[model samples]
Target: MSFSQFGDKFTQHSGISRLMEDMGEGLRTSGTIMLGGGNPAQIPAMNDYFNQLLMQMHQDGQLSEALCNYDGPRGKALLLDALAKMLREELGWPLTAQNIALTNGSQSAFFYLFNLFAGRRADGSKKRVLFPLAPEYLGYADAGLEEDLFVSAKPNIELLPEGQFKYHVDFDHLPLNDDVGLICVSRPTNPTGNVITDDELLQLDALAQQHGVPLLIDNAYGVPFPGIIFSEARPLWNPNTILCMSLSKLGLPGARCGIIVADESTITAIGNMNGIISLAPGSIGPAIANEMIVRGDLLRLSQEVIKPFYQAKVSETIAILRRYLPEDRCLIHKPEGAIFLWLWFRDLPISTETLYQRLKARGVLMVPGHFFFPGLEHEWPHTHQCMRMNYVPDAEKIERAVQILAEELEAAFKN
Candidate 1:
């Protein structure tokens, strides 16, 4: 039976699910030391907090009622207020409950924002969404496709061969048109783990304002990085700037709580769209998050407990890579904050795909670069020389994986 035509945008796109499924199948069959996926290995404070919450809810007779009730789409008011204050104090983005909308996670916020601003034109022309060529996250493209939005990647931000992995946005080369709906940038970028500078953010803000387009900043990995702080809430340079954040990378994915902060007008529009899409997130989710924020324990824990732990692990992983991989053979980005390293192979004989299969055969798994740019084979340079490896796995697993990767690289070069 033929499936009905999905919207044309979706027809041309391969969603994250397909990439994940393929990776999962490889992992199941090959049993390689898995390093490809960005799943965090750190335990979140919320795990213990949730247990305490369960006891309290049970005693208060609120557990069953919460499970049965349909929460309002705007989210729990208390949580929204707390999130706004947290943004003000933590990231310095001036916002309020009116500027915030709670969602299942940052991914939900991403989809909601895309649906709100990325609808089809009456003339059937596709709207455009811009992102960095070497974007750290894959969600931007995935969300854009579902809305039938065209994705345009800028050239890899030029950086010295031996300098930090950070790239600068060359605003001149970007596709700027009335049809461009949004520009998505991740602070403390995903794979490279470098934070976009404030100057860069200001420039992005200006461009978005100039073009009457929205700038979406994904701050999923902002907190743990040094020299990066959101200390005040200034209005986004453009009225169109939309900020999406998550507690997932902050050690709370199961809480399934995230916040979207935009101007009042944008927030109202998002709330309306959210109502149509997801009625409301679980009430308990927000309530628990609210308590975490209000008590200030969450921030303290992130600063004192979680950040240091992950930072040490990241440092150790980088050192291992430096020790094991020859400098001339593999280029490793020194990540400032976040759990990943973007490894670019130099003079490697095998394609990244072949390397991935070989590493998997040896019980080590890593994400090949192709999965990150599924549909743009024509635009990108053809070099299967890159992969994203997460260092947040178990210490023993990380050591084993790196050893296996080093061995594979040597073998590939020999062949």
Candidate 2:
């Protein structure tokens, strides 16, 4: 039998699939230094805290609920209550348990949202999701069910005095047209680690409001809960916005838990979708994370422990890059937050994809930049000249990977 369009689209060998496969297999390869994945490193304090909690639950015979029983499509009632309380107390948002929904992970959450707004609308015209940042998350490239369902505006590149760069939304190029079904972006962006400022977010919200479209914020690596953010960009929520968050970065990716908060109607739609698609969301992640949220422990731990851990890693990695890479030829995006650093090689003799293959042969792994540019229409040279490296690996691994990358760059330049 021939496969349907949906099957074909979903089964396609896309960048995201290759990335995930490589990441999963790379960890088992003893010699390879993995600098490509978005996986969060295990932190001792946080791991201990959660392990103790789980042990306590096991001791009290309360582990069965999370392990055996399936929760509602909206997820565990207690977890929902805890999230509601957290949002209400901290952000002063008029949110309740009814306003929240849970999913398998932020990836599944985005799939629902992307399909919810885009694809076939009431009219014959297919509406599209608009991303304000071009080189956005690689996961988003295949999230949509429909082909050509995403459009994006190129960012205004701001080069600093140092060999650093910033990516800002190019408002002049952003379209406020009827074809757009929604606007979406990742806070503390995935590939570049550029956090979209409050003013920029507010403006995007305003534009969405004006166009009667919802602005979706993928907050998987943002402030408050996981609190990976380093910049001044604070977490936000409004009736005009939809915030999707995850427990992955909090060292719970295995639990496969994600949360979504939005307008009541949208929340209901998402819940319905979750019910139909996933039967019910996973219970364990929210079960553990909710307690952390309610007790205010998650925020404290992230701010005090996780933030500093990654920050130090970023600092050391940046220093190593500075020492190795030729300053006149290479530039790195100043990492505001997140696990990865974006490195740009100016006028490289080969494509970043080719460089990725070379690095793979040399026992180093990194994501090529071109995979992150699916939404951008124009051919931007910068997109082909960059790579994203995660600095969360052990110091020795990172050092070795950086040195290999430096040598690769020199060789590529000479060739």
Candidate 3:
């Protein structure tokens, strides 16, 4: 059976599922060492917290009300208020319930922001959005496409010694137009795992203000890992800035809790849009998230267990890369606070897609850089040189996967 046509806007779109399909097929047949996804190792806290929430509701004889009640589109008051306090304490950002809008996940927060701001010009022309090259998260491009906004990505500018693999945003070289609506960047960026400096954020804020546009920061990986240090938020430099955060990376994706904090006008606009689309985030989701923060389980777990565990894993993975791969042949980024590594095969002769396929054949897998680009073919002609690898897997898996990846790279280079 043929499926009906979607809207014209969707014609040029490709979802993450398509990218995953190729990787999944390889893994299914070859039992490959998979590292393409950015999912955290485990979120047992969320599972336990959710169970406790259910038990409490059942015992209180409020299970039906808790599960079926429609909450305010803005979110449950308790969660928003608790999050406000957490934000102020954790990131030192002054906020309140009126400034936060809860969504299903940070991904939904991106969607809401795009829809809210990516409207046509006064002449009915589409606006363009700028994104960093080789971005850690892939959903931002998808959201931009869904809203019919053009996406322009600058090269991943390096900011490290010898400029080998460090990535930064060069605002001066960015192609800014009057039709540009927003600039989306991630703090402690995904895939690359590099953090933006305060000066860089300040410059970006200045640029956004000069253009009279908003800057959206995806802070999915800003929490301090064991040994690494990174900036956690944009210094209160721009009132027009919108910070999108998720509990997913911090051990609560299942809580389906994410937040968007902006100035009052932007928050109200997004809250209204969310009401029209999602009605409200389910009541229980916010309540459990609120409870986790209020009762101190979330903070305690993040500080005590999650931070050290992931930090060690990341450190170990970097050591393995240093041991197995040649320093000049393979380019690597030392991440400050995220779970993935961006590897560029500068000396390899093969394309990234071909290398990815070869690695899958040899019992390994990773995301080719092309999938992160919005219009893949037009925008990522040189993507064959790059791939994003996750280090959040178990120690045994990481060791095995890194060995396989190194072996595949050696073979690819020899060929």
Q: Model 1, 1-415: lDDT tens per residue? A: 3454455545454546655665687567754566777666555553576578678867877666666777677778887888777767766676778988878878888877775667676787556666644444776666653443645554454444553344556566666667777777777677666666676788878878888878988777665211122222122323478877676765557767777778888878877876887878667666666666766766776666666767777778877887778678777765666678878785777788898878767767787765665224255443367788888777778888888888888888887
Candidate 2 residues lying further than 4 Å off, grouped into runs, are none
Per model, state how many residue pairs clash.
13, 0, 4
The lDDT per prediction is: 0.68, 0.87, 0.70
* Candidate no. 1 TM-score: 0.86
Point out the worst 10-residue segment of candidate 1 by lDDT.
225-234
Q: Over the stretch 351-391, how does candidate 3's per-residue lDDT look in tens digits?
A: 88888777776667687776665522255455667888888
Better of 1 and 2 by lDDT: 2
Misplaced by over 4 Å in model 3 are: 1-15, 22-30, 43-65, 89-92, 132-136, 145-148, 156-164, 223-238, 375-382
Candidate with the greatest lDDT versus the true structure: 2
Q: Is candidate 2 or candidate 3 better by lDDT?
A: 2
Taking all chains together, each candidate's TM-score versus the true structure is: 0.86, 0.98, 0.86
Let me know the TM-score candidate 2 reaches against the reference structure.
0.98
